[model samples]
Target chain A: MNIIEVNHLHKKYKAITAVEDVSLVVGQKEIFGFLGPNGAGKSTTIKMLATLVSPTAGTALIGGFDIVKQPNQVRQTIGLVFQETTLDERLTASENLFFHGMLYNVGRQTLSRRMGEVLEMVDLGDRKNDLVKTFSGGMKRRLEIARGLLHYPGVLFLDEPTVGLDPQTRNRIWTFIHQLRQRENITIFMTTHYMDEAEHCDRIAIIDHGRIVTLDTPENLKKMVGGDIITLSVTDRERVKSHIIEKFGLPVKESGQHLQVEVPGGETFIPTLAVDLGERLRSISMHRPTLDDVFLKLTGKAIREESAGAWSGMRVHMRGRR
Target chain B: MRALKAIYTIWLRDVIRFYREKTRIVGMLGQPLLYLLIVGTGLSASFRMSFAPQGFSYLEFMYPGIIGMTVLFTSVFSAISIVWDREFGFLKEVLVAPVPRWSVAIGKALGGSTIAMLQASILLLLAPVIGIKLGPLMILKMVGMLFLIAFSLTSLGITIASRMETMEGFQMIMNFLIMPLFFLSGAMFPMNSVPPWMATLMKLDPLTYGVDALRNIVFAGSPAREFLIQFSMGTDLAVVAAMSVVFITAGTLAFNKIE
Candidate 1:
């Protein structure tokens, strides 16, 4: 059963097309990830699904309710955790949950029970009375997750849930997300640019320039990149490039001082290549294909290049925090 | 029932926030008191009214206007919270909720009006110090008039704030409009003796009727009651009620279009 079905969704802002003819389906209890760089129409697609932004064309359905005609029903069936923090700073943890519950028309007794259950799940039970302003970054994220689940929506949409957190905190948030999937039996739809994080998703759609370049499971996507990638730093790059081309008929590209080659089994071919090259090979390394490689192969540009500024800005912000 | 509960919850959040921040009470009340004391006392000696009855002073004439000022400032400034919530991302949460959008606007208007009325009530307590005696009936009438004035002013505020995006821009626009509205409302002088053009402008200003209604209620049994009748109490109330409906409808439409 597909919980979310989007058919040729398109969003246009005046003269610019933010999302161009996008379509996908999210199955029940499936952890679907939208992997893309900044401004790849990822957030726009999510906003359309969440019923926050109306599409220029195309349509979607959530829990069998049309997004355009039945917005209230769609809103009731989906929970959204936005990219920016949305909790009232003046309200306490329990107060925030209570406020959300009331807005969703949850009954008093059920609200109280769910409040305790979510608070305990997020490990904020001890600080329920503390104002949200005093909470740490990790604690705030946890509370937001708990708040998103208070209404018990069947599908939860998280927009970069761990963007600015440290590695440890990011791991803990993913743990909570995985636990929620197993314990509550809810489908999770998330968007992220982190390659390692995308590795955790059951399936990922790599979007670039307002289009999905590829959509497949983590292993299958990596497999699309073919075998291991081998790089050799040799004194004579041109000589080695032609030698490999002549000996094995494998295409070799010269990158600065390094010679790069792709083969079926990188480990099995390294010995003969090294023996033939003799002392000309200064250094050599073999690595399994990662999502970054897949992105580079599909888009012809490294993902890191697209997010370089944001990554550095995040680092500066983190350093200032410490 | 669900709509009412949502409205109540939204209104309660504003009340809780207002009470928790103690400085806001002092800040909201400070300006009205200054206008009443310094301006009232200084102008009283220089300005004596011939239209007023024998013993009525200029301070007495300005009292109701000052109440109108308090209500206007408090009610309109409360809408700035909309811009604040937008900047901080909290407004998106409220906007995306399953409830109807008008309930959010109504909740904000009621909350703002309640706060404005509370400020007006505090000003009402100082009536004795200013030589105005209020009976129970008069006190009830004054409270009722203040609530109407607050509700209308708050609706007007929300209507403007809904289209605004930044706090500074909203405050700048409010400052530009509030002073003109205050002066044109004839809060400092009687509307009966103004120039023809000034009278036309004053009649057009909604706050004028609010001030006029307050003056009528505050001076009902006094010697100036007959002169205050120039602005009919029933007419002022009716105009205010109609304006409230118009402004609220406009506000709800504006809020519904927010993307």
Candidate 2:
């Protein structure tokens, strides 16, 4: 059964349209990725599903409850971790989880047990009694993830969950996310601008200009981007390009110092082309299409080109102030 | 029941945060002491030269006002914390919870009021130090009146803070609003024979009745100071209670409008 079903969701703010005709379904325990550049209606759609923002036209069902008609039920069923830090800095980690459980009406008896359970799930068991102010950025994010799960929500919504963390912490968080899916069987619906993160999702919906451009499994989506990319550096690059195009029946585009070729299989194509142009080839490298390539092929722009800041996760090393 | 728990949860967080900041407690308690003991003693000495009533010291007249000042400042700080919460993204977590929006606002008001009341009760301990004897019943009555005032002021603060995005903005606005609320409350002077315009302004200020109610409880034993009480306890309670309802309702409405 699907945990979340969104139908043609739309949102408009006066003269501007934030989300236009967004429709998707997330199956139970599926790791769904809502991939988009900043301000591409990623947050708008997530907020609508979370019942934080009202949809203008379409309706959604979260955990079999209508988002508009039964907002509280939807809220009860979903745990939302916002893009920014939301944990109370003054409170201890356990206290933060306890209050979150209280907000969800988690029973008194169950709350203490779940507090320990969720904290342990996030690997923050030892830091349970420590103040959030004393925590590192990664620890704070883990605690928020812990607080979000204290109520045993059916779906966990993480909005840019790893935007500000270092690569190591991001991997650690992804490990926890996978554990949640495997151990708790909780569906995670996340939005992220990072292409590598999107590669980890069971399925990804690439949204652009407040619309979903494509939705498919990461592998299938990469396949849709079409073929392995093989780049060759040769002294006579133009001559090699003609021989490659004539034999492969494909177009070769010049990419700076290399002649880039796209073929059905890079591993097979590289060996055959290498033998033919053995003495002429200076360098040869092949890579499967990345999500960034997928986005560029579909949207004609790199995802990172539109991202505003390169160091959003600088909170990891800095202890100066929040 | 869930809604009530949500309110309690929010209130608990604020209370925990309040006590955790040890400096805040010291500041809250120290300000009122400076007023009641240092400045108040200096002013009472001049009153002794003029009227010279043994039991009717200026300290007795100003005690309620000092408490009111403390309540006002504490409550406003709590409201500013709401703005801080919003700025720092903590408010988003509360707003997205399954609980109703009104519960969050009420919880904030309760938290702020409870902190203010905590400060007031501690200040109430100083009554004996200032030569004002208070029975347990009087203390209970005083606590109730103080809560009403704190609740209303915190609600008003929330209403204003809800629209504010930054701490400095809320602080700037509260500075413009709090001084008039304190001075016009008749906290420093007896309200019996004020100028007509000043009387009209004091009547408009909600803290005026709150301070008056505190004075009624404090001046019960001394006939000399009792005459300085402007309104009956019932009238003062009614005014502050009405304001409490209005401010809380407005605060809840403001919270509902938040994104």
Candidate 3:
């Protein structure tokens, strides 16, 4: 059954339409990725699902509870890890978790047990008594995840969970997240701009301009191109292209020094084409298209620098620990 | 049961953290001392309120007002930490907790009032050093006054904090609301001898009721005091209790609506 059903979600900020007519359904126990570029309504949509902000026009059901009409139930059912750090620095790691458990109305005995369980899960068990302010960024992020999980929430909303971590720490967090999904049978809904991160998700909804452009599996998304890609770096010119086109009886598309031809079995036929074109080909490579290529194809622009900036910032945050 | 646990857990953590910070402890202890030393001493020499019913020294007459001032300042400023917490996002963590939202506001008020009460008691301990003497009955009355003042002011502070969206706006309201309440309540000057309209205004002021009621209890044995010590004693407490109910209700209501 679908655990989260979002229908035509709309959010506006004064003059700008942050999210417009966005809709999606996340099924039970599935790791769903809400992918988008910067300012493409990723955070705004997540905030609506998390009930941090109300939608201008939309309805979302989490675990069969409405997000707007029954917010308290919605809050109880879903755990949220905001994009920015939201833990109390003055409290110890254990204290923070214990307090979170209490706010969820967990009994004292259960709270203590869960606090210990989550601390170990986050690999911060030894630092339980230490103040959270003294913890490294990665450790703090882990603690935040632990705090959110203390209640064994049915669904977890991770908003840019690895936005500011090094690859090692990000991978570590992903490992723990995957373990939790298997161990607890929890549903995960996460938002990120990284293409590789999207690849890890079971299904990704590629969003741009405040709406979902496409929703499909990564392999299927690339398969949408319908043929293997042949990349050629040619030194010659119009004569060689016409000769190849005339001999092969196919059309050639030229982009500067490179020519792209769409034909069946391009990977198997590349050798024959290369032998026929001889010295005209300075270099040639054959490979399948990736998500970046898909993004480029759809948007007529490359993936943004904002995604790289987010990755490097997270990297610096990780290196600071060492 | 779970809600109580949460409140106590947060309360205990704050208490431990408060003690660990020696600067905060000293600052808490120091403010009451300064009031007793500077204000208590400066006004002691040749100071005689002809309106005072008894021949008690000004120090004897002003001790309870100083206690009121200490409680007033400490109790109201206790939520000042909350503004800091809100800015730092700690307040959000507490609000999102499963415990009822009123617990957050009440726990903070209680924590702040505890310090305010302690500060008031410490100010009382300095009375002998400053040469103010009171009987056992009067000492009991002083304790009663401290409780009323702390409970009332702390609740007021929490109400103000809930309405404040930013720390700057909160601080500004503190200056505009608290400072005037302190001055208009007649903590520093003689209210009865002022012009009639001003005296009526002072009488209408709640803090004025607090100060007058506290002074009457502290110096009830003196015959020369113009403030109706007996009349204010009962009414002061009733006013404080009524105001506490009003402010706490308003604070809790607003806190529930806070995102």
Candidate 4:
């Protein structure tokens, strides 16, 4: 059964269209990922689903309740962990959870029991008394997750949950998320620009320029490329380009100074190409198709290009403050 | 019942944070005490030798006004936390909660009013030092009036702060509004003696009734009672109570439209 169904949801901010004609569904107890670059309407779509941002046109349903007409029911059935940290810095971890539970009107007896269970799940039981301001970035994120789950929501929306964490911390957060999905049997909808993180989702929707480019399982999405990618840095680009086309009747795409080839088995083809090219080949590498490759093939631009712009924008904002 | 619980929890969070910050308590109290003791004593000596009215000393006259000042500052500044919460992202969490949005506004108003009342109560303990008489019934009336004053002023602050996006902008607007409200409230001078235009402004100021109500209760049986009769205790209480209701309704509506 689908827990979330969005139909042509659109959001316009002043003259800019943040989200336009976006539609998708999240199945019950499934991990659905919204994959996109910065300003690709991923966050806007999530906000509309969470009922935090009212759509300019169309609508959505959360747990069978219309997001606009039945906002309170939708809110009760879903939890949101925003992209930025929202926990009160002055409050202790448990105090923060208590405040959330109280806002949701959780019974006192059940609230305490659920608080303990969530804290344990996030491995934050021992640090429950520490002020959130004193916590590391990962700890604060974990506390926010625990707070989101305190009321036992049917669906949880996590927006870029591990954006600024170290690799080790990101892995730990993913571990907690997996455990949450397994133990609670709750539907999870998350948005992330990180390709590796998107791999963990049961299914992913690739959004670009306010449109869904593709939606499928990770394995199937990779299959759209049809084979492994072989990148070669050759001393003579024109000669290698012609040599591969004439010898194997295969197409070669030039990227900067490198030539790329798509083949059924790149590992087996590399040896014959290396022998045929002789000393003209500078270097060769082969790898399986990744979500980044999928995004690049679909949009003709690397996802990292947008990510770089986002990082610089954040840096400029921080510098302006200083 | 659930709405009440949500309001109570929000209020409790403010109170706990207030106590946790020791510097804030000292700063809020120290400035008012300095104003009461230094300004009160300095002006009283001049009035005594020059134009001291019958049965009224400047220190006794300034006591209620000082209480009003204390409550006004505390109540207005408490609403700055809303802007702070917005800047830090905590306000988003509160806005998305399952409770009604007005409950958050009501909770903040109550929290600010309770703290302001506590601060004014501490100032009340110093009444004997200024040679003012305070009967048991007068004390009860003073407490009730201060609560009304605080609630109204805090609600007004929230109404303004709800639309403010930055802490600096909120403070700028607050300073521009608060100074005029306090000055025109007849907190520092007698409304009867002011010029016609000034008296009109004083009458229009909602805080004027708050300060007048406090004065009527604090100087109930003093010789100045006859002069204070024009600003009757009943009228003062009624006006301040009405103003609190208006401010709270407006504040709730403003808070409901917040992003």
Candidate 5:
């Protein structure tokens, strides 16, 4: 069953149309990703679905409650982790969850127990007494995820959950997120500009220009890129190209100094192709198609560095951490 | 019961934060001391007790007003922290919760008032040093006045702050708005014999009655001396309570419109 259903969701802020004609359904316990560049309406669409902002047109429902008409019921059934850090710096990790419990009407008797359980879920059980101000960027994100789960929400909405974290930290957070899906049986709907991050999703909706260009499983979307790219640099390029097409029945093209072909299972095809080419092949390499390629194929432009690159974000964060 | 819990939880968050903010504690304790020492001592030598009731010293008069001033700044600052919370995105956490918006406003006011009252309680300890002997009855009366004034002013603060989008606007209000409210509140000067225009403004200031009410209770302990009471005790509290409802309602309405 779909945990969230959005129908023709539209949002217009003054002159700009932030979200234009978006519709989709997210299955229960599915790790759904909204993949887009910044200003592509990713955050705006999520905010509307999360009931933080009312849509200008159309409607959405989460956990059988209408987002526009029954926002209070929707709020009770879903947890939200905003793009920016939202935890109170003055409060300890446990205190933040304690306050959340009361606001969500979690029983006083069960609040402490749930608090411990959620903190443990995020691997933050030891830092419960520490103020959130002292936590690192990654740890704070983890604490927020833990707090979001304390109410036993049926669904969790995360907006750029690991935007500023390092790569290793991002991977760890993804690990926890996968575990959360498996253990809690809760649907996870998150938005990301990082094409690599979308690869982890059960299905990705590639969005651009305030609309969903395409939605499919990551592997299926990449299949549109004609599978993994195999590049073979040979001393006798024409001879190898002819041999590849004759024996392997695969067409090969020349680019600069290398002969390249698109193939399925590039890793498995490499050894066989190397034996088939033998002495003529000097160097061989494979480039797997990523969600970026799918985005490029759909939008005709790469996700720009201004919004999607993680390394640029990493440099700003590394100033103090390292 | 759940709504009440939500309000209490929000209030508790503020109290816990106030406890940890050492700079705020210092400011709270130091502001009243500075006002009492500088204003009271600076005016004591030049002033005559002829216009004053019961031959009361100038320091004795400014004592209650100084505590009211402390409550004023602390309470307003507490409410203005919402602007900071919005900037930091912490306000969204509260806004998106299943709890109603009115509870959040009430919680903020209660929290600010509690912190303001706590800071004012420290000033109560200095009463004996200033030559005013306080009975337990007088302490109870003063505490009530502190809470009422604090809650009312905090509600006023929330009403003004809910629409403010930036912290830059915060300092401007503290200077251009709060300063005038304090100066005209009859805290520093005699309200009975002020200029016609000044008296009009003083009557309009809520802290005018708050300071006057505190003075009455502070001196009520010492029956031998008569203190200046601007309005009847019941009338002062009634004004505070009535205005609190107005401000809280306005604040909640403003909060409802926040994104």
Candidate 6:
């Protein structure tokens, strides 16, 4: 069954259309990943589905309940884990879960039962009484997941689950997400900037500038890009464009000092092409085309660009405050 | 049953959080202590005069006022932490919960009120050292006064907090609205001693009613202070209660409206 059906939803923040006529259907027991650059309406879309933000236009249905008209019902069915940690730092992990469970109208007996189960699931059972303030970042994050699952929600919405964590912690979170799916058979809808995380999802939608550029399975998306990603740094773009067109007749997408050649079986062609075009190439590198490569091909810029801009702007803002 | 449980659960979480933040707890007591020690003592003899209402000592008159001030500050800033929660996403957890939106706002007010009441009680405990004496009945009346004061002020604070889009904006409003409310309500000076225009503004101020009401209950049957205190408390409660409903309604309306 399609557990979540969002249809042509539009959310405008005054002059800015944060999400414009976007739509997607998430099936039962599947990990649906929302991939986008920063400020691309990924979080906005998830907020609408989670019923945290009302859409300016259109509708979304979660578990057959209309988000606009039946918000309470929509809220009941969806559990949201936001981009930032939201647990009460002063409260113990169990107390946090207890309150969260009660807010969803879970009975005392049931809340207690589930609380223990979730704490064990997150591996915070031993430290349930310890204050969340003392917990590490990854531990806090794990507790957040436990809080979300306390009510046994059918569709869990995780927004940028691993944005600022180290690689090892990020890997650990991925394992937990997988474990959650295996144990509960719950549907997961997650928004993330990490292109590599998209591989774990059953399907992904590459969203940018308030619109979905494309949607497909990870393997299918790579297949659409059609070969190893061949990136080159060219000294002279005009010479290189003509040289590549005349000599190799291979199609190349030029993007500011970088030429991406997406030939069928690009890895096999790279060595021969490199021999012919020696020294003309400032650099030569080959790798399997990833979601980032697909995003670059479709959007004409890397996904990392917006992320870098967001990070620097955030850093500057924080420093300015200090 | 479930709804009540949800409300209690939400309320309990706030209580737990406030209890855990030791600095915040100490800060709550610190303000009232400073008012009692410095403001209440440093100027106690200097400000004392027969012209003062009922010929009461400055400390005696100021005790209830300090109690009112404690209620005022704590009650209004109750939702400050919520703005932080909203920004951090803790609020989303609550917002998406199955409970009603009014409960959320009320739970916050109740939490803030509890803190205010606690602060007021602590101020009352320091009453003896500050040279104010109260009978057991008067102590009960003081508790009632604090509860009402805290409840009303918390509603006002939560309302303001709900309307605020940013934590900075909320803190600004707190400094702007709360401090003025305390100063203008005759907490720092006798109402009769203030300028005519300032007196007129105080008469209109809701905190003025709170101060007057609290002062009357704490010092019952003082002929000079009786009429104004009862009149202010009675009217203040009604007005504040009505205002709280409007603020809470507006808050829930905004919560439902915002995207």
After superposition, candidate 5 runs with Cα above 4 Å error = A227-286, A304-322, B53-55, B221-227
RMSD of 5: 5.3
**Residue lDDT tens for model 1, B63-155:** 889999999998988866887788777888889999999999999899888888888888998899889999989999999889988998888
Clashing pairs in 1: none
Residues A107-173, candidate 3, lDDT per residue (tens digit)?
7788898888889998999999999899887898899988888888889888889876889999999
* Cα lDDT tens digits for candidate 2, B41-116: 9998776624435656788778889999999989988977887787677888888888888988998999999999
Candidate order by TM-score, decreasing, is 4, 1, 6, 2, 5, 3
By TM-score, who's the top model here? 4
lDDT of 5 by residue, A67-108 (tens): 999999999999999878789988899999999999999987
**Worst window of 10 by summed lDDT in candidate 5 chain B:** B220-229
Q: What is each candidate's DockQ, to 2 decimals?
A: 0.43, 0.59, 0.26, 0.50, 0.43, 0.52
Docking class of 6: medium
How high is the TM-score of chain B in model 4?
0.94
* DockQ class, candidate 4: medium
Error of 2 at A223 (Å): 1.5
Highest DockQ: give the candidate number.
2
Regions of candidate 6 where Cα sits further than 4 Å from its true position: A314-322, B1-3, B52-56, B130-132, B167-176, B193-195, B221-259
Q: Is the docking of candidate 1 incorrect, acceptable, medium or high quality?
A: acceptable
Give candidate 2's error at residue A98 in angstroms.
Answer: 1.1
RMSD of every prediction:
3.4, 3.8, 5.3, 2.7, 5.3, 3.0
lDDT of each: 0.87, 0.86, 0.76, 0.87, 0.86, 0.80
Write one digit per residue (lDDT tens) for candidate 6, span B1-259.
6567766876787777777778887888887788777877778767654465655677777788888887887777665667667766567677778778777777777787887787678777876775556788988877876876787677766666666667667556757787788888887776766689988988777778778767767666665564235365567667656655666666556555533
Which residue ranges in model 3 land beyond 4 Å of their true spot?
Answer: A225-288, A307-322, B1-20, B52-55, B98-100, B132-147, B222-231
B71-114: candidate 3 lDDT, tens digit per residue: 88888777666666666667766765546677776677667766
What is the Cα-based lDDT of residue B101 in candidate 3? 75
Candidate 4 positional error at A29, Å: 1.4
C-alpha lDDT (0 to 100) for residue B209 of candidate 3: 76
